[model samples]
Target: MRILLVLFLLAVGCAGRDDGEGVSTQRERDSVVGASNLPGASGVRGALRAADSANARHGRLDSAGP
Candidate 1:
């Protein structure tokens, strides 16, 4: 029936649209990532910082050569 066809089309359209529930904005992401209480968070910025610190601690990134 046309009614069932219309309902199916509407459901398909809704399913195709993303409501952005789990996605975080840059600021919100920054706030959580910037909180140092989280140890070794997988955020890009945090991971980079952690890598830099680890390299520095191990003398791996020194210009004088490892």
Candidate 2:
């Protein structure tokens, strides 16, 4: 949740910039990278990815061979 909040703030801040300059894609990308690098977020993301991989490998229910 906190990581999401930080990302949101970064996006909003960039959007509200004045000086007639439009949105900066670099900053947006940086924000995403920064968010992913946040402490605990990486672990959570890694665990989720691992879970998905494991599920894909063993998702089918079948009877064991005798």
Candidate 3:
């Protein structure tokens, strides 16, 4: 039937729209990479170091007696 044909076409068309923008942004990432390579990487390394410190602090707190 024509109704079934239209419904099938609609379903197929809708299914292809979720392909996640269909392009790799990595190829365009060269410009920003050098910026992150600068002195101390502008707190990026510090941020990761802070994560470990925070986890350690939380572990200490969790183990302390009330």
Candidate 4:
């Protein structure tokens, strides 16, 4: 329960950005980066890749759920 609460708060807290220029800056960056055309993979794939890359140094993240 405590972990769930912490995770909920973490999600909410990360929802807002405090950069000085606001939404327009993000739009400009996205336009330049073509953010809309990203591959249709779920974030788990990215996490798996990251975990694989760090395997040599720190080992992989476990499957235990919070």
Strongest candidate by lDDT = 1
Off by over 4 Å in 1: 1-42, 60-66
lDDT of each residue in 1-66, candidate 3, tens digit only: 999999999999888556577654642343244357676555655565576799999999999969
The 10-residue segment with the lowest total lDDT in model 4: 56-65
TM-score of 1: 0.27
lDDT of 2 at 19: 52
Between candidates 2 and 4, which one is better according to lDDT? 2
> What lDDT score is found at residue 55 in candidate 1?
79
**What CA RMSD would candidate 2 show?**
14.6
Looking at model 2, the pairs that clash are none
State the lDDT of candidate 1 residue by residue for 1-66, as single tens digits: 999999999998888657678877775676677665675555756666776788797785466683
lDDT value for model 3: 0.67
Instruction: Compute the lDDT of residue 55 as modeled in candidate 2.
Output: 76
Q: Using Cα atoms with residue i matched to residue i, what is each candidate's TM-score against the true structure?
A: 0.27, 0.33, 0.38, 0.24
Per residue, candidate 2 scores C-alpha lDDT tens digits across 1-66 of: 999999999999889547566656754644565468577766666666686787776754333334
The lDDT per prediction is 0.72, 0.66, 0.67, 0.60
Q: Using TM-score, give the best candidate's number.
A: 3
